[model samples]
Target: MSDRLFEHSSQGVSRGLSAGSPGSGRRLVVEADGGSRGNPGRAAYGAVVRDAESGDVLARAAERIGTATNNVAEYNGLIAGLRLARELDAAAHVEIRMDSKLVIEQMAGRWKVKHADMRRLAEQARALVPANPTWTWVPRERNKTADALLNAVLDGGPPVWEVGASASTPVAADPTGRPAEETAPAEASAPARGWGAEVGGATTLLLLRHGETERSQAKRFSGSGGEDVSLTERGRAQAAAAARSLADRLGVAAVVSSPLRRTRQTAEVVAATLGLPVEVEPGLAETAFGEWDGFTFAEVGQRWPAELQAWLADTSVAPPGGESFEQVLIRVRAARDRLIRTYGGKTVVVVTHVTPIKLLTCLALDVPARAAYRMELPPAALTEVAWFADGAASLRSFGVPAEVPEDGEPIHG
Candidate 1:
């Protein structure tokens, strides 16, 4: 529904989710709700940003999350609200209220993700904020907007809503109530950016990074010629966790990988999960590290501190025997262009290494070169970015999802 419908006096003030002071609330208040019909069945999430006191929506987000459980859907809703509020204003202190108790406790560090998928997703949510985006648990009654949005998502929408359904105290479901909301998949709230590809013509690349490698495991510098060491035991576990999670969420799609074992093995994990083939893309390989290929961080610092510092300080600088960040970016960019030209709008999984994923994220976010260096990816973690026909891109998620728990320490990652 066009949220603009809430902008007029013509429609006598319907009881908005706010009571006496939503608009005037001191902090930005985020109310998020999500639901799945069969736990892991069809689901959707909705979130609304209220000014706090006077209960006016500064922004609203709602969408179908495909088939996920209520908990996953709820986390998606919370993360969406957190991210929207951040994009709208970074410094704005937000008081996020959710109807999911699991999210509240997990986000509060009271729960450990016994489930691998949930653990990773939990991490993704943590990365959404600059730091402490203040999450709270509210009674179902208080989260009316998010609830309504979720219900709308559940019913498919043929849109249970119209442009102006008289924004009264939003039609909340009676937890036990049946909604009269329309039923069809709600059209996505016109993406922030456009991807003008033919219907189903846009090639969607699911940019994935390999799980931990021996280099990553040993905190050693790893690059293109590191002999393509395979994923360490934990790396294998991370990749498997990711594969199972992706299989549940995105079902399956094409799988492509760097021939390097770290990535090739990662691809195999996902391929096994999705019953897809692993297409090797040599162009997707990690950088050729030349001389310092498998050196430890301490070794690199002791021997090549000057060179390392210069490269870190400037992406244009190359390692003693490795390619410059810019060079990697160029090759990855070419590979990406080629993929898009080939696949268009279809969602395909691309399992590769860190530099390429972060570089692609930087491109999508339109940030500077130094910014790519600032990204922090996890072992067997996942991030998503989308590119459009007009050359615009958006970072759907960077690093990993909060499906897994973190150290409760706030991160700038």
Candidate 2:
């Protein structure tokens, strides 16, 4: 959703007519609004810029953020509005109008931004403004246009645009008792500079491992060929915690999960939190452990010593009828490629198994298969990889866990 927001902003900032270019001395009025169906569910925001003197719409922006809090969505709207205003007129005196007192206060520096996500967004917004801009808190009634635009996008309608008075349209209020307005911008509004010249955009992956099952706690080899078990109560709690953390931090574009019960459940939790849906991928499933399913490592060593040794020694070696690390790497790579193509320059959460996660991480880091063995992935732990538009990859973090309550028993394997 952040990617979509950035795309819209990029187009508006990079290509549109400059306010100083046409109407050189007009004061700009920016009205913005953000909303969430579940306070953090089905989030979207809207912003519209107008010539304060003529009351003519200059440019408008809005997008549906996957899942985010009311506050986060509000901040996003503010950022979009300010960015649009900056792109529209570099020298126009701008006045921001919103119904969100929280955003007004915080951006005004009267309230401290504590959340890492909000703070990051705030910084991005501040970077666009070279000088102090006026901030105003208006009643919900006066902010209907922006509010309507937000609702329209959320309702599967078109985004806001810069509309001229001659091409004006009717404004509708949100049925849920919120003020609403739609916009139609009359001109192209892109930034003065190229959008992705120095650092090309990135597709960020938030990789997560599935939670605990009985086999996980027992230190057994559970694979896709084995019985697909659901997450335990403790695992569910861990997933919930992780969902909360991610909903707050990740402006996730989509949630993709392995086609396994455990992974599906975990992904569901996350998707619910983000107000997004889950997409299952067979390539993300765990390796087929074959004859070793549900067997302990020691048992596997005793029963299939030669196979075990061979498997550990070579990435190409398979266990009995099981898959090889190299094969796992192949499928995982394919999945990564598909994801990058499908969601380029976006942030995605991938719920998968340990081997897939490790292999994917290793692939992102340009490491050999042996690196997967060195990495230890805990149940519900998260790892992040950023893939750039120029084909470069970077590992942002690994083995990161959400702030979960100390109630669940530790997973063993």
Candidate 3:
């Protein structure tokens, strides 16, 4: 494999022993695996290198990479394994074995790398490829060594090796090889952040409800299946007001929005003011209300009274041919997790609809899904939630009004 597959910066690149230098012409085997408990939560990776000839272990590496997806962790495992092999023998004929088919195929050039994060990781792994490298897909059972290492780390054991360290170095252990006191899980010694004490930095999400649509002004059910509505004049004014408010905030890293027209229009106003592009997150779109779309609550009650009652009484019940609260919760949760993973330690503005914003608020507060009904989200309102590395969330504000100037002029920060 060519070393110049990607032309990235020299920063953060690990360059090991040169080819034909010492520790050359050897054969090595690298096994790797990674996992996440909640898909994008509490992630880690493990990798082990072995002498191909004697079947003896050469090095082991594992680490807890907080808040990542399974695919990201797996790519990390591959990178760690490749790095270890390079340290042992840079010119070795390396056999890279991984349990993730996605990583394997992507690395081997058979599958395309899609996610931006995955593309970066694939590039790093490619840079570490040795001479005559062979990519192999192994079953999960055959990757037990690496899996065990990751599990041990996740279970509060010391990391086998630290990042940028050679194979011989260990981390978070004393001279006697016992885990250090500081290495204990935060919950064991420190009080939960939810109880009042602050821990590490958090990813703050500023959730902005979309501006007023015609349906919104009329108290109609405007969902994904309904007409793709544009922002009314009042909605445009509200969006402009929101944009002015957001422009004053520092460290506003990204502006994300639902794919629907109203949310996109609102997001565009904010993004343009903040000098950032709008990123669409489909999970933030309004719920599919099916046949109930574009109807008033009273109209729905008159037509599908049983369905509406079931949906209102039970979170799992769907409107006729529509999505259930439970279903929206699942998708919204996934999108929230992805945003947390992608924008950790940063502030992101999420422009979405009432249901998604309410769902996110419910999640941050650890309230029942049924509580969505109790929340009052007005048009172009803002809610703030901070998500920490340890999975604790703090609700900072809710339903803050987006104030417009009385003279109908643009409000500047």
Candidate 4:
């Protein structure tokens, strides 16, 4: 059989000769694919819609769908692609392409969808397909864009794709996220100039630390491994104040937060003010403090003095049964890179905790891990970092406190 197979639907039968030909009404080409690390292990799907005439990417979507078979993930990609195309232009002609022969044949009505899950996903995909659609099967080599997106998500990166990104444009690699290597010193390269001085637009991350928790107020070691804590009343007020501050900033595309309750609560306030949904990013969670959680410095010193000293002195030393600063750096770096890739040239509010924020700031500055200790990030404070396309980062601001009004109203600014 040929490397490419095309199947035209009944509605496309009349227009098959010129389905995607020039001058057609908004012809779109959708390339989608899915992958599973263990066939039923971690899985993700990636899809991109491009303008057929210009070959420019119109929209991109990718998601990590927990554990699933490769076939399910492929169908999910098709569904996501169709949905994106429909959202772009309902009347446009959509040409759906995939590397999965099974998905292509099933979607083309050439094979039966025997599994219940497959049937449901297929139906959902079909429902979103435009009035007249074309199904095409292309070899894997032709579908690298979608594959890259899928792999990025499976590798502990965020499930986001840049809209209006070029089809041939490569996703930025994790330049500073490697666990084994030390981040390059910022001084090694030319200093970053003011905004718009970089080669391309920057991805601005507005990092907002979570509001005051009980443990935080007591100066305790509040980490992810310990009890999940909520924000205090003051914390809520601080979140609202921070939200008001962010409301004045223009062009914030989305609000993302750690899964922990304190950060989520803070993110909820900010997202509500911005009229955007809160996206949970697990990598932004605080470092796990294990047995030392909820303990003050004095207490930890009394209980496990040697361990505390070792942890304080080394980045790779983990607390008893908890994560090390090095581990936190790895995940936070992954999260930062994912955000940069997903929201290139856009602004995003990252609601997280102390360690992640400090680590991110340190990474952007290309400073050593120890620098995280020198920084002081108060609860609900906002820091800003701009990541350029060329792997350079600029630290715009650090630990700017929210201005809470005396009258209980949100202080805008």
Q: Order of all candidates by TM-score, from best down to worst?
A: 3, 4, 2, 1
Error of 2 at 36 (Å): 56
Alpha carbon lDDT at 384, candidate 4: 95
User: What tens-digit string does per-residue lDDT give for candidate 3 at 1-413?
Assistant: 34523322422111222223233667787888999999888888898887777756777777666667899889878877887777566777787778787887788787899986687678767878865466777677667678877877677654444222234332234555443332445454323345586778899999999988899999999898779999988889999999999888999999999999999999999999999999999988899999999999999999998888878976646677777675686568668867876898999999999999998887676555678999999999999999876555788999997886666444665
The models' CA-based lDDT, in order, is 0.65, 0.74, 0.77, 0.78
lDDT of 4 by residue, 10-123 (tens): 322111222533333788888899989998888888998888877767877766665778998898788778766765677887788788889877877878999866776786
* Best-to-worst ranking by lDDT: 4, 3, 2, 1
TM-score of each: 0.49, 0.51, 0.56, 0.55
As for TM-score, the candidate ahead, 1 or 2, is 2
- Among all windows of 10 consecutive residues in model 1, the one with the lowest summed lDDT is 158-167
Name the lDDT value of residue 389 in candidate 2.
Answer: 50
**Candidate 1 error regions (>4 Å):** 1-202, 250-252, 401-413
Q: Any idea what lDDT model 1 has?
A: 0.65
How many clashes in candidate 1? 49
lDDT of 4: 0.78
Instruction: Please name the candidate that would achieve the greatest TM-score relative to the true structure.
Output: 3
- What's the CA error at residue 284 for candidate 2, in Å? 0.6
Give Cα distance to truth, residue 289, candidate 1, Å.
2.3
Candidate 1 lDDT score at position 323: 73
